[model samples]
Target chain A: MSTRHDIAAPPTEGGAAPGRPAPATGPTEADRRRRARLSRRWQRDLRWSPYAFVSPFFVLFLAFGLFPLIYTGWASLHQVELTAPTDMTWVGLRNYTRIFDDEFFWNAAKNTLMIGIISTVPQLLMAMGIAHILNYKLRASTFYRVVMLAPYATSIAAASLVFVLLFGRDYGMINWALDQVGIGKVDWQNDHWASKVAVSSIIIWRWTGYNALIYLAAMQAIPQDLYESAALDGASRWQQFLHVTLPSLRPTILFTAVVSTIGASQVFGEPLLFDANKGASGGAEHQFQTLGLYLYEQGWVNQHLGRASAIAWTMFLILIVIGIVNYVISRRLRASS
Target chain B: MTTTLTKPEDAAPPVRKSRKPRAARAGGHMHGGPIAYAILVLFSIGSLFPLVWTAIAASRDNNRLAQTPPPFWFGSNLFHNLDVAWTDANLGEAFVNTTFVAGVSALTIVFLSTIAGFAFAKLRFRGRGALMLLVIGTMMVPPQLSVIPLYMMVAKLDWTDQLQAVIFPSLVSAFGVFFMRQYLIQALPDELIEAARMDGASSWRVVWHIVFPAARPAMAVLGMLMFVQTWNDFLWPFLVLTQTGNPTVQVAVAGLGRGYTPDQSLIMAGALLGTLPLLLVFAIFGKQIVGGIMQGAVKG
Candidate 1:
């Protein structure tokens, strides 16, 4: 720590504070030559420092990020296990074929897509509404913004655990609230649709505020004059939102939508935690099993590393397809607009 | 736009006229009516309800929680649950592990990203733009998609069940690099770098002295983001650190809900313990975090 403090001390002591540049002094010929010589020597080393600075990330990425992605493709071809990876037998395209035939894989995929859509659509809409509301000059907006992000601060595991209690079948607050409202007690974890709703509720609860804040930021950046002009033209708040805010927020909306979709597709922790009683298969019947959980169940629990690789690659393709679709749609919107 | 507005007006003249004031030019101190407030309040409650419920449950023991209506208020068992969480639940070790991993990872991310950001933002070097773009591009590739391979890599390095399995993989975030680079581009000037260079300071010295201090607000935001993310991360840690000894707070909290004899109060207490520190941090640095996320989203 002291060594670090020592290394850091010189710049703080010697360099001017931000926004204040050092004053230029007239340099004598001798001084200029000395500086040039020093610079020439330093320049040789300086050329590589940026590379040195940036290499750590790329190195980590290559090892952990890119290599894994590419290796998943290679590994999926072979029949491998977590423990005995070297004794693998290559069976090209067999794992993919096998996963395709596996009903559990399809079940998991459907669950993932269902939950992703169930969570994402309402989350984004609520986010937009909240952003619109918060964009207005409201008292204690900062406090609301902070409160909105409270769920974001909570770890997914912790949040899911809390939700488990809330969504409890017999003693849950949700059922209690429903009972108070004269509705029947819905078995949240047992029923198919109810479980999806319960799971999506967790996702929605966590992300809506975060997405709203993003939209609010974009909304804030929209020229205030646009709204004023719209108002001067006798447009109502609804009309202004439709004609002004919504149109202006297209890029940000698309961006957030794409990001949210990508994130939702990889829903792991919530379902994993939500399936507390049902083990890691998502449920006894694999009701809420997402692809992420399936991958874990396969690779870690079943020890079928090859099959997990196939699932990983499948997820990658789905994301890429969605990404390309989003890109095309966004580009078209930009072009038409 | 005018034609569209007129069309809407024609379609629903009375409804449009009635809603006019609500939409009355933007930038007012208030938006929406009592209905909007009601909706926001309801949604806010919905958002906070789970945590509130958990807190209530945490205060109650198993029997009280199993009551027909369930306990809705603080019970005497709060301390007992916390004790169980601390001693019996393995959360004490989990807390220690989480702090160590998150702290180390956040510090490393900030340090590496800031320098890389500095290099990308101000340093004139060959392939700088391309390299920076490559770094930015990695953000598009969701890391979870590569989990299988990453698992193998960790295992190959014999790092499984270790905290470094979590820390090393996350030490340098592409998002942090991009975020820092963007901030530096706007906050820093080439004149500052040249000025320091002219002062007979080494390049490293110039960066440490001039660029880093100036980049603190950005770095702090980035570091806080990383810390919170690492604290909250589950899947990677859950996968790598399967051992009871190495479990992160999040993994430990997850484990609370997974057992055959799952204790509601203990789980709730454990969740609270895992969540509260970051929530407190959120309360303190909420504005900066909000700003950082907003800026990141907007810039993207």
Candidate 2:
């Protein structure tokens, strides 16, 4: 222990030497010349290496990312479809205008937002609570942590299909359980709100554990000393959790929230599978059609590529705004922390 | 002070006195505590119930599954459903095509991202920071925005319905590059590269010998993630691989539900088969996958 302590102490002293050079002992002429040469070489290498290391990303991005985004924006301005390619015409802002007037578009937007809020809030809260439990001294912590991530890893398409069976009205296990509890069977697919609820439940089920594990990791990083101090001061577990754990987890929470929002906004597979019986239009009335499904319907099903591209751009803009708002909030929270 | 108060239970337990107090406290906590556990267990069951149900339902005859208060237990029709799905959808072809597309796409993404990420993390050149910023910036833009243009491009190239359409467009993954860059930044120390250089190793040699070996774990994580993403992907595959014979797994499953009253057992069997590889991948690399996600979250 003494040897280890001795080894660590000299690093601080050595670091301080660079900060405060010994008087009249800074450098000899040879040392000065050698230092200057070394510094110039180091600067040159630093300048070259970073660019060399980072150029491939830029090259690929220019080709794939930037060009595609610009092209999408351009495509959105034109009136185009899959079949009538020869009838391409520029229709400025018409697609966007159509989206505002379209009831189906509005319904999709509403469903997307509704599902986003319904799934993300409960998912986050459950994650936080579960993480708190996991953070405590527990046996088989690693096993639980690994097990929790299973739903997230499961294929979305497969999970959605499974969920479709589970949410089936007559013979599904969910209804059977509900029947056992004296509740009547819900026509999960027939009702709009129930369908939305069922879809959101799938999202929450898959993601809650993943988010909880993340929160647990963040919780583990919080100093045990803080918890001890809180305990000594007569703070209950809940109180300490509220005051310390929540505040400490603010950034991670915000991150999950933003990601959840982005993910939710693009909710497609669940609703697609949920309404597959309705020709993948999300529902007969388009009740559960999210923005993502709307985009899919416009682009693929109706072959209205221009309008679909417009919706995609609109989604992108909304995501950017939400992301910026999230960034601002996260920064403020981090500053306070 | 805190240690002292909590230490009594650890040291010599004062038999009767300690037992009584501890048991009382434990009992009080337990009544309130099991609620959380109950809820969790319930949700866990709810979460896995569908998968379990699918397995059972897939094995049951149509008549059995269609019965009221559906049979929770398995029946002897697994092969029947499998045979139906296999012959009906020609899933054997779909599976091969899906595997080929996913495998090629994943390998391409790994190769491209690793090289690109190594360049981004280690090589110092002009516009390095700007390029990285640009790559990270693109991550926020949903892929939906570009699907139209991408569709147009594929159509113009006569690549629509071709495997290349699926494989090529997904080659440049921003998240993969970012992930690999982060991993490389930490794993590949400057000293190691400097040492390699000092020993007269060329730049390519330095990267291959010094950097690539250190990046295996990160590469594995990236590979697994890409594999799962590619395998499970529906939208792009559905759009691009529109040919009847070349349908991907998800596309094939979607097609299964499109015609006449869909065969529930057959569909479930197909879904289960489609998800099997993903489940296996997760089972094996669940820790690294979770770790990679958490690491990305922290860095972001």
Candidate 3:
């Protein structure tokens, strides 16, 4: 196997001394034979060391990563409870079929989709605009970047705690400001759409700056000549951004979209903490309950292990389908380009 | 997602027409305008105001916080509230527990990822491509899919409420391995490894003397990122660790706001205490963290 690289060729026995002088009587047959055996041992080390190096990660991944995934799928086909996770009865596809009739599941699914769009779309567009502005030679840009990233540094628990207080209907800062400006108070937690927007805003607030930095990285990496060429053609700044910058950033845009979608689907902590009094029920009427929260409610809160397993598999299946569609679209884009 | 080259490439640019007269027209006035600065200023406030207000709210009494037109300025009761949150919320223990868990996890992840990354980056091993693809695939397997079995194993091993329950599952990261592999492939030259080999350096010696030194910067950065991630991880920790007994920061903080009549200021204080350490981390090593994310984003 080490034959792939010419430079890794095994050394010949006794590989001539670099700066030391050899004895006039040279090497005895036994000395040369011993050196040849040492060379083979060294060659063996070279050949096998890479496997030794990489085994730890694969081993850990197998145990904690791969096995659990398959086990969850297997457990989904049975009826089990949190009281005794080991006690299982065969109920093939019942959990999956029950999901079809589960209204809470559908509500969570709808909320997940709406929240995903609300959170991801504006976050990315704002990120794109910010990244464009940041491409300008600015003063104290790192300071801006760091300050923008401060929200990201805040944990979900902490951020949600702060936001819940800020968005309180009666005594919150936003309502106070709105009242001062002659606007009526809005019940953020009780109102269905308002609650979802409030939840989505937390995600957007945390991630927009991060995605902006990513886009900024991509923008900085754009070859300057592309801009110059566009300018030579007398394109306006906005036009250059549309024609040149946007096209160059296609892959980065797709990348962020995929990441945000995955993140959006797994929206748990924000909604969970946003309604701290109600715990896993997202809201009083389950208005903003995402799939992730629903999974938690079924498994941990309600102790329906089999149902939770099914939800897990269902989420995985949805992600896989989306991934396949993404792959096809990207492939077509690549082909056409 | 792995197939996407969404990460910005940091490759060296080809030759440019540096002296061309037309270059000035393209980007000579690249500085932001007044309107741009205004927008940036507004965004910065939106980004930072909640954190600033958390401090204000933390310093006030519970009654003050529950009143309309919340205190915009600091209150004298900050230290008093912090003291209460510290003792009542068991944040002191949580801080230590979280530090140990995050530190051990980050170090293990960095060390293992570097060695494995070196293998994937340079070594000519059997099934290298397939194995690397497997590593990439592992990144997309959501934690929700895998937690039930991990929970079962933890319960079986009597690891519930133990730091090991949290630490064990986070010991290695696929992203760490991928990021390191990307770095070493470009940073560590093959010629150098070949020279070391020619000098009869054993595989271990080559890793120690050559690979690690080349990987020091990336290793440090990756350690910080992993630390932040593990520090902020909530769901799994919430499931396993009980707040009263062995809470991490998030669990402890989450516990603060519960019950029929909660102390509002005390909750804010706990939230502030839990968030301050990492914000300190961001304040200090932020630029490097920014660099790390962007660098890892491209190939990672």
User: Which candidate has the highest TM-score of all?
Assistant: 3
Every candidate's DockQ is 0.34, 0.24, 0.41
Which candidate has the highest lDDT of all?
A: 3
Against the reference, the lDDT scores of all candidates come to: 0.80, 0.73, 0.84
lDDT of 3 by residue, A89-123 (tens): 99999999998799999999999999999999999
| lDDT by residue (tens digit), candidate 1, B86-204 | 77568878888989999999999899898888888888898887887788678877888777777777777888778888887777489998988877776665666665554445667
**Which of the two candidates, 1 or 3, achieves a greater DockQ against the reference?**
3
Each candidate: fraction of true contacts kept? 0.67, 0.39, 0.56
TM-score of 3: 0.92
Model 3 has a clash total of 1
TM-score of each: 0.89, 0.84, 0.92
Error of 1 at B140 (Å): 1.8
For each candidate in turn, the interface RMSD (Å) is 5.5, 8.1, 4.3
Q: Clashing residue pairs, candidate 3?
A: B7-B298
Question: Taking the tens digit of each residue's C-alpha lDDT, what string does model 3 give over B71-139?
Answer: 899999899999999998889999999999999999999999999999999999898999999998777
B-chain TM-score for every candidate: 0.85, 0.84, 0.89
What is candidate 2's DockQ?
Answer: 0.24
Instruction: For candidate 3, give the lDDT of residue B9.
Output: 18
